[model samples]
Target: MQPNEIAEVLNRPLSQELLARDLTRLAYVATDGTPRTVPIAFVWNGTEIVMCTTTNAPKLPALRHNPAVALTIDTEVHPPKILLIRGRAELDLVQGIPDEYLQMNGSYEMTPEQRVVWEAEVRSLYDSMVRIVVTPTWAKLIDFETTLPSAVEELVKQRAERQGA
Candidate 1:
């Protein structure tokens, strides 16, 4: 997809909901040449998707070796809102806690006292974290209303041709 097309899909209201969502399934190739998909927390900053992980995360090595990745963000409803993305992972190791991490988890409900405790624990446990940043090269949004899957579109085309013939 062209950059403008990707941006248009991502800027749609339904896509915005997916971007606001807390989790996305991150898909990448592992070191053993196997595909791995894991549910991970993410924060989309309009231009990029940022996911924080431990400095020594297993995915880090795989991402470093092969930067290509895909992500799926969707809903569990009947007419699910789906967002598919393809991008390259750029790992940035930041000292101390990443603010994006905190902001991404901020939506979860917690008592003020619990929040403080959680922050302390997170701060004490990790000295640094790896931010996996993905700048989308391609994207598609399927809300099943304004848009349909490519396969569905093709099926519709065949049906119309047969009727006309």
Candidate 2:
């Protein structure tokens, strides 16, 4: 999709709401050519989706080899609202903890004291991290109220033609 079109899809209110969600299912290809999907915390910084992981994460090597990826953020309720994004991952190896990692994980419910302990543990555990950044090249928002999957939309059209006949 064109950049403008992708932006249009992402700018919708439903899409914005989904973007604020704490986790996204990141789908990518493993080095062995197998597809993998893992739920990971992420932050959407208007233009990019940022996810952080330890330097030794198994996915890092796979991502380095093949950067193409897709992300799905959705509601668990019936008539689910889903935001789909396709992008290329750009890996940034940074020393120390990245602020985006903290921000991405900030939405979890935690008491102030618990949060302090968690931060301390995280700081002690990782000396460096890899930032997986993706600038969306395509996007789609599907809210059953206003939009349906392409196949479903086609079925609806066929049903209308049959009824009209």
Candidate 3:
């Protein structure tokens, strides 16, 4: 999709709500050829979704093998609002701790003292970190009340035609 078209979808109210969500499920193909999805902390940087992981993370190998990925951010309530995105991963490896990682984890329930301890422990444990960057190529917002997946929209149209016939 063109960038502006994607921007339109991302600008929608439902999409805005999903983007505000703290956790997103990242789906990618594993090296072993299996599909894997993991819940990850993410920050939407207007034009891209940025995520961070340990340098030696197991998923790193898989991501290296295949950069294509999908992400889903949604809520648990009824008439859920979902934002689905497709993108290619761009990895940036960095030494020492990263500010983005700390920012991503900040939304979780943690006291100021706990957060201080957590940051210190993370810095001591990881020699380096990897930032996974993805510039969304496609975006869809599915709100049962306001929108549906494109495929579902087509199916609904087809069913309506059959009924009319």
Q: Name the top TM-score candidate.
A: 2
Distance from true position, residue 104, model 1, in Å?
0.7
- Across 53-143, the per-residue lDDT of candidate 3 in tens digits comes to 9888888999989999999998898877788999999999989866778788888899999999999899889888999999999998888
Q: Comparing candidate 2 with candidate 3, which one achieves the higher TM-score?
A: 2
State each model's CA lDDT, in order: 0.94, 0.95, 0.89
Model 2 clash pairs are: none
Candidate 1: list runs displaced more than 4 Å: none
Q: Given candidate 1, what's the lDDT at residue 34?
A: 100
Candidate 2 per-residue C-alpha lDDT over 18-89 given as tens digits, one digit per residue, 9 for 90 to 100: 999999999999999999999999999999999999999999999999999999999999989999999999
Runs in model 3 deviating more than 4 A are none
Candidate order by TM-score, decreasing, is: 2, 1, 3
Better of 1 and 2 by TM-score: 2
How do the predictions measure up, each by TM-score? 0.96, 0.97, 0.93
Q: Report the C-alpha displacement of residue 126, candidate 3, in angstroms.
A: 1.6
Q: State model 1's lDDT.
A: 0.94
Model 3: weakest 10-residue lDDT segment is 12-21
